[model samples]
Target: MDFFNSALGKNITFVRPEYFIITGFVGIPNMKYYYIFLFFVYFVSVLGNGAVMALIFLDHNLRTPKYIAVFNLAFVDLLGNTVLVPKVLDIFLFNHPFISYNDCLTFLFFCYTCLCMQSLNLVALSYDRLIAIIFPLHYQVKVTHRSMLTLIASFWAFVVTVNLIIAGLLTRLSFCKSVVINSYFCDHGQIYRLACNDNTPNLVFGRFLIFLILWLPMVFIFLSYSYIVYTLSKIATFHERVKAFKTCTAHLSLVAIYFIPIVITFTMSANIHPNARIINLSLTSIFPPMLNPIIYVLQTQEIKVSLRKILKTRMQTKVMAKKVIIM
Candidate 1:
C-alpha cells in the first residue's frame, strides 16, 4: 500500500477534461445527483444480468445454442461490472479512491481483457444466431455443446494471451504519479498516457489489437447479420420472419452496445479537437454499461420472464417460512 499512502495518492487529478466533464454535460443533465443515478443503473444492471445468468444456469428448458450464447453474454457483463462498479462506489462513498500502481495496472489489464472478451462473446453469440438462422439444418450438429465449450475455452485462452502480451509491454514503462484516474475505473488509455517512456509502440500495437478485437469482429458480424436478414427475407410467412427476427433481437441489441461506443471513442481518442474530446471519451466510459441491462431486459423475453420467476420464488419461499413459524 506504499503507493496508496504516497503523496501522489492524496491528490486527485482529473486527467484531462475528457474524463468527467462531458459526462456532466450530456448525461442526464436534469439530475442533481449524478452518482445516485449511476447507482441505480448499476443496481439494475446487476439484478437484470444476474437474473439472466441464473435462468441460464437453473432452467434446463432454456439451455439451447441461442440461450447459451446469451448466458455467455451475461457472464461477460457480470464480470466486467463486478470489476468496475464496486471500486466506483468505494471512491464515491469512502474517499478511499487510491489504487496502488500495481493494482491499477492489473485492473487495467483485466478491464481490457473483459472488454475484449465481451466483444468476442458478442461475436460468438451473433455467429450462433447466424448459423441458427441461415443454416438451420446443421444448427444442432454444428453448435453442439462440446463445440461451444471448446469455443468458450479457446476464446478465454486467446484473450488471456492478449492481456499478458499487453501487460508485459506495459510493465516496461514507468509511472511517476498516483494521479487519481478521472474516470471511475482504471481504463487503459488514461493509464497509458501516464507512462513516462515512449508509448508509440504501445499506441500502435494497442490500436492494432483493438482493430482485431473490435472492428474485425464488427465486420464479420455485419456480414453474418446481413446474410441472416437476407435468408429471413426468403421466408414466405410473416410469423416465421418475425420469429427469426425475435431470435436475433437480443444479440443485435448487444452488438449495438458492445461496438458503438468503442468505435466512437477509438476513432477519436487521438488528436481530437479540444472541444470534442470530452464528449468522445465519455461515450466510452459512461454510456454503454449504463444502458446495457436495459437493452438486455427489453430485448430478451426470457430475461423478463426469468426475473419474474425469481422474484416470485423468493416471495413464495418467504411466505412458506412464515406459515411454518406460525404453525
Candidate 2:
C-alpha cells in the first residue's frame, strides 16, 4: 500500500498522490498569451455581469422575472469564473502548479455548484420566456417577483445538494496509484482516472449526474421552446413573430453554448488528443460566463436605453459642475 505519505504537522491522514500537476497549456511557447486570454475572459465576465447587475438593481422598471433570471445568471457567471480562472492565471503566471488534494476537492465543489446553478437558472429563464410567450396576459400574475425569487432560492438549494452529493462520492474513493492529471485544473474525469480501485461506481454516478444536471434541463428547455414556437405560430402578425424570435435568440444561444459543448466534449473524449481536449475544456469554462451578459443584458433594448440614460445624466452633471467651477 504505497500511500503518498505527507507529514503536515498534526492535521495528517492516509492520503496518496499528495499533489497533482496542473499542465494547462504547458510547453506552449510564449505562455503570456494564455495569461492574457484568461485575464480578458475573467475581466470581461466580471465587468459585464457586474454592470448588468447594477443596472438591474438601479432600474426598477427592469425588475421582472426575465431580468431576474439574467441577474442570477450573471451572478453565477461572476462566481464560477472567478473561482476557476484566477487559479488558471496563478498556474501560468505565478508558476504554481501543485494543487493539494484537499484544495482540489474544495475547488471542484464550488466550481460544479456554480455550473449546476447556471444550468438550472437557464432552465428557469426558458420557463420565464415560455410563460411570457404562451400566456402573455397572465404573465404578470404567473411569474411574479415572489415566484421568481422562490424559484431562484429553490435552484440554489437543488444545485448545492447535487454538488455536495457528487463531491462526497468523489472524496470516498482511494487514489493509491497514478496521480498525474493530464490537463488544466482539477477536472473530475482527469482526477478520477488516478484512482487505483474500480471506478465504475464513480463513472456511472457521473454519467447519471449528467443526465440529471444537463440532459434533463436541456430537454426541458427544448420542450419549452417547442411550445413557444407553437404558440408564436398562432400569432397573426409578422412583427410579433419577429419580436418573439429576437427575444428567444439570446436564450437559445445560451442554450447552445451550455449544452452543445457537453455533448461534443464527451463524444470527442474517446478519440481526441489530450491537448485538444485541454483547450476544449478550458474554453468551455471561459465562454458562457463571458458571453452571457452581452447576449442577455447589453444587447437588449431596455438595458441599452438605461445605460445611455445613465451615461447622459453623468455627462450632464459633469458639465454643470464645470460651469459652477468656472463661476
What are the per-residue Cα lDDT tens digits for candidate 1 across 143-208?
987777778778889998988878776655445543534554665555567755456767887888
Where is the poorest 10-residue window by lDDT in model 2? 1-10
Name the TM-score of candidate 1.
Answer: 0.77
RMSD of each: 7.1, 4.3
- Total clashes in model 1, counting residue pairs 3 or more apart in sequence or in different chains: 0
**Whole-model alpha-carbon lDDT for candidate 1:** 0.69
Candidate of highest TM-score: 2
Q: Per-residue error at 153 for model 1, in Å? A: 1.7
Local distance difference test scores for all models: 0.69, 0.82
Which regions of candidate 1 deviate over 4 angstroms? 1-32, 92-97, 175-184, 268-294, 302-327
